[model samples]
Target: MNIHQLDINHLKSLETPFYHYDMELLANTLDAAKKAADKRGFHLHYALKANFNDRILELIQSKGYGADCVSGNEVQKSIDMGFPASQITFAGVGKSDKEIILALEQQIFAFNVESIQELLIIDELAGKLGVKANISLRINPNVDAHTHHYITTGLDENKFGVPNSELEKAASVLRSCEHVNLLGLHFHVGSQITDMNVFKSLCVKVNEWKNWFEERGTTIKVLNVGGGLGVDYQQPDENPMPDFEAYFDVFDKFLERNPNQEVHFELGRALVAQSGTLVSQVLYTKSGIKKNFLILDAGMTELMRPALYQAYHKIEKLGSSNQEELLNYDVVGPICESSDCFGKEVTLPISERGDLIAIRTAGAYGEVMASRYNLRDEIRYVYG
Candidate 1:
């Protein structure tokens, strides 16, 4: 809704339904995060799954941040974008053989190995390549992220990290693997986490597990507390950036570590969400007895969070008239699916065809999740 950072006149001339990125905001966010992490000697690896826009990746890489990749292509993209192999970390529950080999060839910093079988397979592949692979055990701390169920990943039921019951076996497998080097432990509770106490709970689990591994005679080098810091979707303007200082302070204050150990984070949404906006033009306005609908040229094909997660993003009618009249309407996209709606009962100025609408807090997952499901046009972007 607050788009003063964007060139409104230029936005009006472009075709409707494009993502507009505020490069300055992104730079500031990165600087703030980097300074916070650096002051506490924490390391940051930007999660590429969040956006991965070429320009965005270029800027993020320019800042010397590491890459947190979830797939094979992502690993290559990070390298292609100039992120050093030593700064890239591959993580996923279902990694393919090809991905493993590519990562092995790349000599990435570490693989957040999720299962004992994955550990054995990586070791086997590394042995075949005659190279030692650095790995960190992705431990399922079972800590609740207290966020969306769809985004939660650290619970016992989630298929992300290895369960506590299997740690003994994982250690046994690690002891037997000749080509794999144990780096440390990795734990990602979930995504879009807002509660600081959730992280505190996670710190407790991390400490417990680190001690658990140490008691078994394994030396820990890195403590990768995966990132899930939430953004202010409800008020993106008021809080354009997350409190990086407080976030890092949480780890500094609570997380116990040794002088030789390193602290790392894999942040995705918090770094980019507020810096992007989805701009679309109203296609039509239809008023019904039960519901009023403002159809837009964009839909779930463009931004899937609403349809997929019932997510809330601040929607505002741009170019409000001096005598603007407010009304409640269901803002929807022109897609054929009923779930294509963006927001229901959204209050905005009495809008008409050609009126511009800005969907805020969309920088992270919005553009990356776009699809051609409805044979829609390829998404476009505008940067300022």
Candidate 2:
């Protein structure tokens, strides 16, 4: 809104549905994140799983940030995109033998080891490679992120990091492994965490764990509190950037880190989610018996968060003039599945066929999660 970022006229001339990325907004967001991280001397690794577009990757690389990869392909993409192996951190619940071998060959910075079995596999593979595998045991703090259950990962019930009960035992096992060197402890409460108290709780747990490891004479070098800062999905135009300075300040104030130890974060949504929008066309306005329906060309295949987590995204009518009357309608999509609906009882200006509709706050997970369901074409990108 500040810059009249997207051109409504230009959007109408283009194809029906496509993802539009605000390159300027992305630059600003990255600058803010880096500046905030610099204030506390924190290291950031852009999570590649968020958005792996080459252009996006290139911009991130140019900012002198690293990559946080969740899979083998993501790791390789980071490398191929020229992100130094020293700066890349790989993390996932289930890593295959081949994937571990691939990462071992790449000499990745550290593996956020989730399970004891994964620790052993990495050690064996690293032995075969004749290289020491750097790893940080991902410990579950059991601190509730207070976010959606699907996105929350640090709870005891989640199938992610090692639980608190078996952590000391896992640390002992990690210490005995010859080929795998324990860098430190890793933690990720969840994604879209807005409460700073959760992070403060995580810090308290981290301090306790650090003291526990130190008692066993283990010198922890890195403290990786994985990123979970949330963005405003309901109002991207009003607040294009989240308070990264405040976010970093929370960790700086609470996390009790050793003087020489490094602090790192793996941020995805907070970095790129506010920089893009999904633009679609109003295919038809159906006069239904119960209520009106605004059928859109874009659906769950193009942006699946609403269907996956029942997420909220701000919708706007780009081509509507101020004189147009506003009305309430269910914004449904062309997909056959009933779950493909974007929003229910949405109020927008009077819209008809060919009216351009813009779905805001889609940069992080929108284009990346697109599917070819119903034989519909996948999302195409247009950078602004």
Candidate 3:
């Protein structure tokens, strides 16, 4: 089913704001990404931080995708939803000691270690449990992914990974840790990266590190090039597939791999962003001397991307006929915060009160980030 059939007519009857997911579209996207990865024998792990709704997780698990979790709860959630523990890779910069112990109890496939301290912590916890915790050191290659500074993680300034200067020291510490088994290396440049050249640069960095590890008589078995593939928010239809072929092709070409080495990816947004839409109704339209405002019932409370990332989502009226009349409107929400505006100078068909507004490409960082700020009503959902 499409957006037109997602109970938009009865949307107002249920609630003022909620997220609607196109399951068919999401499945197709998963299939597309999975097929691309499978062609090159690359493993695809769905980044649960993107969208962890139980229904979404179930479908993704059904498609044979592993779970890339950042917390203990996410690992439990994935396991509860039928994802295999052997397929789960726990990753985070600040995992708590309790979280580490929980993962050790579950025997997760690997922990993406961000720092040497974290590696020692994991070793201590694993020693307590009398089990070797498999781990992959997250390396900061200092490659500029050319994305937003806030989202760019591989740079030297970011606190997400261990810098190149610390790699040998981290490796030395890992070798001395008796309870931790060094699995391989992992690198994540940033999120919403649209440029293929950034990934090509990342591949070059991965190759250099792989050789570095091999030179030390340590073979890197798993090379996890973390996912930051950007989706086309401007033109969803024209580039819906998200260039997975090109993304996997880069690794297939530039990444030097051993016969037994397995390449893995942790994809989040590109798999689910276009498959969902946050459908809301325009409560009022007020024109002022300075600007016209479309007051939406769904604020950043429902979809926080606009407020948090200053991100853009194409907004369209569901049944409006005045498509040709262009007008500038600051799409505002009922949230009391001044920063709750979705977009400034957003061009939409002349909208009116009670007209449905569909926020396109909200499937990824949309509803999962919703909150009850301003004592707002509970958000709902309609799956197609």
Candidate 4:
């Protein structure tokens, strides 16, 4: 269910400027995604970078999904949340010595090694620990995700995976690292991706690279096509859940792999975006000769996507008034910066002081990216 279906009186009484998570929707989303992946013998790993709320992780773990972590603490959090170490895959461009050591000690599934240098470091750390580290080469496939430039990750210029030009060098380095065991390949183009053709193109790149390694007598066991599925930010109610069937169908139809190979996905946003909403109370309303404004207690400090990436989120005024006139209002936050605006010319009903507002489709990056920039109260969450 969308935020509009929530009990207005209940939300209004507790607080303003807090996250409201619909746990039922989250469960339904997870069930749908898992069913689709399991039907195709594909493994799913929840990317903890999306929303690492304790309860969210607990519910996700209860579904028997793996953990895709990018930080040392995330790895530990997954462990603490009861995600098996063997189901955890640690991936990032720069892995500090401490992080690498932690992952090694935990014996995570594999490290999606980005560069030849990182491979060497993992090997050194693993050697000191007297253990072999399983690693998957994170390859830069150069496929454009057709997303925001800041989020695009697979291009040759991106600071992520090892580019094609360096594969030969990486292979040579891999052969020398006695403590590092090569398992497979990993590719992540970008996030908030909406196009299906992008996945088809990625399959072509994965095929080319997979064959390139097998030709050299390398036995590839895992093919991790990292997730970039986008949710409907414009129309959350219309498309509450991403089409898991269609998404998995793209890979199952196009990707070529050995019978023994295992496919993995690192999904974050698609599974949780629709289940979250940012609720706030309108503090005041202002009218200028040119524009109207609805000042809210919530700011970029509460939901930073609109300012950080120019992201779009549908805004809804709670407690519908059948006779209230619809008017354009620029929704803004109390943050000091001028960029703290949430939406410009946002159309809403006649609003007033203490009017409730719901910022839809904020479940993914909203609360997780919040800051205490203005010494704002620690973000709170309400689940139903």
Cα deviation of 367, candidate 2, in Å: 0.7
What are the C-alpha RMSDs, in order, of all predicted structures? 1.2, 1.3, 1.3, 0.8
> Which ten residues in a row are the worst by lDDT in model 4?
1-10
TM-scores for the candidates: 0.98, 0.98, 0.97, 0.99
Return the TM-score for candidate 4, rounded to 2 decimals.
Answer: 0.99
Q: Candidate 3's error at 170, in angstroms?
A: 1.0
lDDT of 1 by residue, 105-159 (tens): 9999999999999999999999999999999999999998888899999999998
Clashes of each: 0, 0, 0, 0
C-alpha local distance difference test of each model: 0.94, 0.90, 0.89, 0.94
Estimate, for each residue in 1-384, the C-alpha lDDT of model 4 and write its tens digit.
Answer: 456777788778977788989999999999999999999999999999999999899999999899999999999999999999999999999889999999999999999999999999999999999999999999999999999998999999899999899999999899899999999999999999999999999999999999999999889999999999999999888898999999999999999979989999999999999999999999999999999999999999999999998889999998877788999999999999999999999989989999999999998988889898978899988887
TM-score winner between 2 and 3, please give it: 2
Q: Write the per-residue lDDT of candidate 2 for residues 1-384, one digit (tens) a residue.
A: 321455677767788689888888898899999999987899999999889989999999999899999999999999999999999999999999998999999999999999998999999989988999999999988889999999999999999998888887797888789999999889999998878888889898889888888988899999999999999988787888899988998889988888889999999999999988888899999977788889999999999999898899988888567888888888989999989888988899988988888888998888889999999886788888
C-alpha lDDT of residue 326 in model 4: 95
Tell how far residue 272 is off in model 2, in angstroms. Answer: 0.3
Off by over 4 Å in 2: 1-4
